[model samples]
Target: MTTAPFEFFELHVLRATRISPGFARVTLGGAGLGRLASGGRDQRIKLFLPRPGQQEVAVPVGAGTEWWPAWQRMDADERAVMRTYTIREQRRAPDELDIDFALHGDTGPACSWALTARPGDPATVLGPVEEDNGGVDFRPPTDADSVLVCGDATALPAVAGILAALPPGMPARVWIDVEHAADRQELPTKADAEITWLCRDVPPGPGGPRGATVDGQPAGAKHPMLEAMRAAAVPGGAPYAWLAGEAGCVKALRRHLVNDRGVDRRRVTFTGYWRRGTSEDDLIRQAIAAAA
Candidate 1:
């Protein structure tokens, strides 16, 4: 059976505020939000921007396979460039709302736009749909065993969101990698989750940094993140593990957790949020192509 493509929402920034030194929260609202799926974590969305002086233009929405033709028809400069981002938070009441964007020195369009965003800015928004895991919602087993969650800055919001949403007294251990010590923020959660933040002084490598091991070893050296994760004892049993970040690092961590640690493949979820030398749009294109 074929699933119908989801609809897009034409929204405008109702407000934009800087939450941290390198993060911005933009709130969007419009009638189109009626189609958004509630509480979609780590879902990607499109934000259609108007060229310097253009008023309005048509932007493609819905599934990639069916939307490509309309997108192709537009002039290169006029077509909207889509970027994937996790839905940090959402509010469906008095209309609709979303918060996201990480400020990374203007390396990409989304970051560039977010750094300078203001109230009333026009940006067509779409989606709050299931992402890489195919809509699977795997929570840590209550009576079973241990839990491990690992990710970098791009995956922070989702990790944080998951942490905050966990049921009280749930046992899990989480590891997060960020650009600097200052980038570390409190992740409030009711679950009995132990979180460790890995901060690197060195700029992110070819791929975003997954952080050097505590002993100053290279990222791939013994799979630093995975090693740290392994050292921490899983209380319940063999814990369900989640790993997400740069393609290479995520793949390696996934391998270490499942192959070396003997974690069941079905109990682990790994995602390559981004790749080295590629923009979010490129990643989206690659995913769409692979899906096709």
Candidate 2:
């Protein structure tokens, strides 16, 4: 049998702390966490949170790669609330992993769990066991002379990790959108990065700020993040762009970068963290349908 790159690991909530106005950092520790090898920049993971009143996550952990089908067969209400998140940092000295949750004061299960996750609380995580795994999205090509990273609050953990992993003094233009000025974080990077932080005075609705559309310009839309990107200039040489966060924004940004900005589509890596007014379950269904 071939070795699987990802596997389920039981994660215990060692502690939760308010790292910023918009983020809650949850430190998870468990016996097998040493096997969870994170590739650093934009390392993604499937986080399984127990529903209210449940003692632990309800996923079929022993099923390995077949766990998805097994999970869907379980009762929806009783099953674990699956959400995608980034690994902010992984330390093996004591086998601990830090995950940052962007709190929007919404009714989302992940947000609710993060707010009240207590020490010793149990959850499940499907994370990478290999360093060079598909879970990591940020991959700047060798020939790329500069980097452009854009995302909303949901992508902060990835942005921070990407900047930290950049070669020393490499040019990096980063734009991040947060709901409030207080949410701004000091991202330490050795990449000579010029980061622009945008704070939305009022977000339209739940998922995130309404961002650019397919045309790269939504008529009468007040997208500060897109406008900021348009106003700024990128490096002349080949540039690798990594964009994520709200589906609308990522779509719009990717369009602008490829169509308007003339960046090659192959050079851009884009992902939609979430769609406005859509649940992760719905997105999962759409993904499955599309794949079918």
Candidate 3:
């Protein structure tokens, strides 16, 4: 059976706040956002950002699969930038949702647009309608007794969402790496979680690069987060591991869990949220290659 097409909503920024030195929170509301009342953890949506000199935001409409190509066909100057973000919270009664964006320097289109976004700023988001739950990548087995979660700043919002979804008393452990001390935020969870914050001591590379790899190690081997992850002990139980972050580091961690640690391959879930020097599209291409 053919799945239903996703619905699109034109959102206005209700508010914007600097939650942390490296994070910004944008609250968006639209008439159609109430459809997300039952959204799941790590739910993702694509944001359509206005191109340079554009004042109004318009969302393309068609079958789920068709909208993308149709949007791509539009004149380059008329097209809005597309970027993926996780829904931090869904508030139905007020028809508002929260999205937490990781702030790097104003280098990329999405980052630049967000840096100066103000209340009443117009944008478009393609999200799930009432019929579907959209696409959420985090899936830990219910029968598992312990959960292992790890990521860098890019995956922090998703990690927070997953922790909120886990049941009380669930044994969970999290290791998050951040570029600055100000990047850490309180993550509330009912699960018995042992959280570790890994703050980097080295100077960061220029904010974006594609397929960046270190010599004699994995792609993101130069990142300190991977070393911390490598040294940590996996909690003993029927553990389900969910790892996300830089693509190269993710690959290395997955190898550690499945090959070095002997965790069941089927019980591990992983995603490469981004790469050190690549765009989201590049990450998608790498994911496809890995699957092949």
Candidate 4:
């Protein structure tokens, strides 16, 4: 099979609806989307959203090795805002995709855009042009006896997609952290999984952030997800672990699994979907520095 080069496509909001207190699902469809086949559950894509007051995203063509440098050189007013999001669902006949955004009001650009996004809002996406794109991150070995999955509200869509993709009656354990009860939603899955919802002490409201803290954690504390994860028993027999959400929690969970729980680091797949109080540019710089 030949690999397809990642390319950008212009899309528009077919619809936008509030799914839960913390999530809003946006459906996007446009031309040049037929090649986007559903390959895996944790599929990642980049969304180039219009900046404030802009009607459409104006991104440069030929986004390759030089794309970033050129983009950085562009005037700040002309550059579009880019964000990473997971594909919540895909429909082939209509060639449309669903993405769930954690709406935190005016806190972040993506959240702000999603909160006000209406039908026909123009956007751009960078994704694979083939079904078997390698960007899918949740790869569990076939022989693994059980599975462990955990994340905060930001990862709910990916976790649900992954659970639905699991083989029938596979044993799994899932832990999800949210800021309030309203943030919880029905996670339909065929896998035999025990799901624990960790609700933080803070109540979610119009201005509050979801998954900003863990249950019983004091204000301004760290590793609430790690503490919650530690309290639960890992599934038995060569279990594969998939972790996501905040970068600090990802690191803490990885550390616990590898250093304390005796799980092989090789069996764990983790990604820092976002970091608290950091921008996407900061994350890109951090990745570059780590690679260096």
Candidate 5:
């Protein structure tokens, strides 16, 4: 079941559905699910997927502190594939976990598995057992007067979760980047938030889209997410910002908010979901190096 902060649960696929042009929703349910608790708002979990030709994912469950080292020592072709993802939603009564996968058309192992995952497909997830665990990252101070959120398709689930959890009527400025306009989905929020969806597929002619300018350059920049944030007028007086998505883009957004917009560095929460050009295998290699 649960061991204070984190624990492992043997899970299986209940269903997999393509909800958008670039997203897939996979529901998981199994034993010990009753002990799994989600901290909501950008809850993170490590999903263990089986390697090709394997029936079930192989991981050292309940290894606790030794989980990482033990996993590293396992045969690469036999061990489970580990990937980080945000909890889209968690339900009870029947006890089910929902995870949204950003489909990359087979580039990512998780994405590839999700595309063809069948009901009863075995998997494992290392998740939190308590409500106040450290996995949830969207933490806004009590004194924050406004909120700013920016992300691409990879961060959509976390962004949506943050918006949904925000206090009623809290002013929020949100910008979401997607590859296609059809990828936009309904994000329900009670906050006084202005949400902007930028589709890179749509060309922003000449001067820029909507006549906006980024750092004296055309507003319709190559990476519209960064350009839009740089040009937008944010509210003053104790604002907290949350940024995620591409590594370079998140870095630039954080820099813009802190150095250029005067937002306190401590108040901003930023995470890089992925790098622009790096493959998933590259990340695996990097993780192995770091662990070593």
Candidate 6:
């Protein structure tokens, strides 16, 4: 099987359907999809949005250092905006995949585009690349007795994916916080996983806005989802935890799980899927900076 550069992949929207009050499922089709690995639950892919009236977008083929010059040489109007999204579901036989977009108003490029996406629309698929460990490694070599997966609306697809892929009877717990009660959807999983949803009925909290409460208390004040997780007494033992969502919430959960609960750092995978008040590009930059 030959794998091409992420940028070489073409964009073809096969179908789009409303999955829920706040989510739209867009199915895309292309050749060689089966060859591309099915990114496990919570895995992300970058989408390159085409400019108006443009049929294709050029993607650099190699390292940033080798690709920057070519990227800079392109006209400003021809450049496509990049956004990250989760692989909600994938089917190989038909070479099709579905990505669920959270319809949280028109605040960003990808959200805005997805709001109006229709069949036959165009989009550039960027990555289904391997993780840092190389290839798919769902079972990490760790001694933890349980697993905790946490995230907000942005992380739901990943949470659902992880749940569906877990080995039958594996012990895990999932915590999800979304903008509203209607955002909750059925998760398919055979693992001994308990999922709790924390609904924030108010509009999304403004980025950088401190002291905003989800209900009558601060957003973190016994966040319903976290409280439920903490209260659950897994008789087996402490488990490795995976946390993702807005940068602040993820960071806070990491601190709570590690500093407060004394979870071993090696067993935890925490990611900031997005930031409250920053552009997707800025969020990526921030993540890179933090890792650096």
Best model number under TM-score:
5
Model 5 TM-score on a 0 to 1 scale: 0.92
TM of each candidate vs. truth: 0.79, 0.90, 0.85, 0.85, 0.92, 0.80
Model 2, C-alpha of 229: deviation from truth (Å) = 0.9
lDDT of 6 by residue, 40-130 (tens): 7666676777765676655654533344345545565777766777888878677787888877664576777776777778776666544
How many clashes does each candidate structure show, in the order listed? 4, 0, 3, 0, 0, 2
lDDT by residue for model 2 over 160-263, one digit each (tens)? 99998999988998888777667777788899798877765443444444542222322124555677788779974899999998888888888999999999
Query: What is the per-residue lDDT of model 5 for residues 1-292, given as tens digits with 9 covering 90 to 100?
Result: 3444788899999999998888889999998999887888889999999998889789987688568788888898889999889998889989999999887454677898898989999989999888888998899998999999998888999988999899999999898887666678889999999888877555555656542322223334466677888878897589999999989889999998899988889999999898878876688788889977
- Candidate 4 lDDT trough over 10 residues, lowest sum: 212-221
- Model-by-model lDDT, in order? 0.67, 0.84, 0.74, 0.79, 0.85, 0.67
The lDDT leader among the candidates is 5
Order the candidate numbers by TM-score, best to worst.
Answer: 5, 2, 4, 3, 6, 1
Clashing pairs for model 6 are 42-158, 146-239
Candidate 1 Cα outliers beyond 4 Å, as residue runs: 1-5, 51-57, 61-65, 128-144, 201-224, 284-292
TM-score of 4: 0.85
Off by over 4 Å in 2: 201-221, 287-292
Q: Model 3, 1-292: lDDT tens per residue?
A: 5654466788889988888778888889877777654355677788888887888764576546677556656775677877888878777677888888887553777777776789888888888775336477777776898899988888888888889988999988788776666778888999999887765533334672322222111124365555655666777678998888888888888888888888898998888777777887576456546755
> Which structure is stronger by TM-score: 1 or 4?
4
Judged by whole-model lDDT over C-alpha atoms, candidate 3 comes out at: 0.74
Alpha carbon deviation, residue 21, candidate 3 (Å): 1.2
Q: Measured by TM-score, how close is model 3 to the native structure?
A: 0.85
RMSD for each of the candidates: 5.2, 5.1, 6.3, 4.7, 3.2, 5.6
Range of the 10 consecutive residues with the lowest summed lDDT in candidate 5: 210-219
